[model samples]
Target: MSTQNVAERAVIREARPEDDAAIGELLVEAFITQYAKKLPEVVYTDERKRELRDVAARRKVATILVAEVDGEVVGTVALFPPGAPGSEAWLPNSADLRGLATAVRFHGTGLAKPLLDAAEDLARKWGVDAICLHVRKGAEGVGRLYMKRGFVREPVGDMDLPSVFLTAYVKPLK
Candidate 1:
């Protein structure tokens, strides 16, 4: 199908319990598969995979949003309130966004934008002054999307994890 058609028909909504497995699969495919080349194989430990697959665990702390195309889950993103565990939000009154992943087949189909829009809208509704997120430094394409959407790179917030380096980005809502 055409990119435009796929994007036009996609629905962005809060994920239901039944979506847990699909979201987990999408996250693993989008992250581990793509980052394996740039990151060390050791990073793909079973524990890490389990962490990526734990959508229900994340749902307890964040609002899990998914994009469904014709009844198939194709994309997912997590929006976390400030002070929530695993939240990298440093700016006061900011929300944290993470796990923005799209299925390989849906890459470049403009699906991420809607997921991001929904997160930003939810952030505004929650009275946050900004939305913060971390992107793997090697994921230039994903970083570009955030930059294009007005997320400013905050080098001071960059993190050097044992397996991967992350660059922080923040977009002010005010």
Candidate 2:
């Protein structure tokens, strides 16, 4: 991230099959860091790690996107198209955004915003009228980020995971 503007470190692009492993590693690392302070147990669990590792096998790479810096995969996000099988619960003409993870070292390097913009761009390309994503209740920073990006909280489901209450937000595409 040196010698160029902070945002120049990573170049966002469509992810390929070969990127699956790197993306999984990024997710595991980020998830572990996220839980290290409060939910340390999650950091030691292999079940979740294995599930993350199986992402490539279960998901279509074409539906994934990555951010690379000097040939290293540093961030990943998934944009599920409107009406996609697993995304049927979303409002009509609205796509879903999930699986957002970024390398720890790249924090504060402005890598995430571009990746998010890319995801929204993808949703708009699908001719969707809006895009939706979920954020855990306590993740105020994440919520603020979404709000800053025009997302408005619109609670949807009660299927929360243990202590983490999941809430949905939607941002209309114009």
Candidate 3:
């Protein structure tokens, strides 16, 4: 699939074990920037970084996916099956979707939409009726994108940080 970015020309697919490092890099880059602006107190330490890498390597969810362009990883999104052991507020009554990250260099080139589409396809394949995610209230742009794609907001409580209410968004897959 040709994209506006000449360097990107591929479809999204399941993430391979070998992609853990690349995926970790993408996540660190994307989240570091976002968290720096949103939640400066959220420290991304070495242990936390290793934990994320380990999760990516193990592929515990069976739904981790990555988008590659010309053999270079560009973006990724994963749908955690319902009943997973986690306290993610957005995930209540739905499959928890997380780890939506893209290479810093590939932002604003429309790669995210395709990644999300692939994630939704996986959720449907797993027989999940709905998929959900959380976005910080300050990140209105991110929330708007999900809203535009048919996601509706659900009530969520404030997290540990003030002014950072967890805005849960859900999209019905059925």
- The best candidate in terms of lDDT: 1
C-alpha lDDT score of every prediction, in listed order: 0.88, 0.76, 0.73
Stretches of candidate 2 off by over 4 Å are 1-6, 38-44, 161-164
Per-model C-alpha RMSD: 1.8, 2.6, 3.4
TM-score versus the correct structure, for each prediction: 0.92, 0.86, 0.81
Q: Pick the candidate with the highest TM-score.
A: 1
**Model 2 TM-score (2 dp):** 0.86
- Flag the better candidate by lDDT, 2 or 3: 2
Q: How many residue pairs clash in each candidate?
A: 0, 0, 0
Q: Which 10-residue window of candidate 1 scores lowest in summed lDDT?
A: 36-45
Residue 87, candidate 2: how far off, in angstroms? 2.6
Residue ranges of candidate 1 with Cα displaced over 4 Å: 1-4, 37-43
User: Residues 80-161, candidate 3, lDDT per residue (tens digit)?
Assistant: 7777655363444567777887777777777888888878877787787788788876677788888998988876533444
What is the per-residue lDDT of model 1 for residues 20-134, given as tens digits with 9 covering 90 to 100? 9999989988887778755544357788789989999999999999988888999999999988988888888899999999998888788988888888999999999999999
- lDDT at 157, model 1: 79
Ranking by TM-score: 1, 2, 3
Of 1 and 2, the candidate ranking higher by lDDT:
1
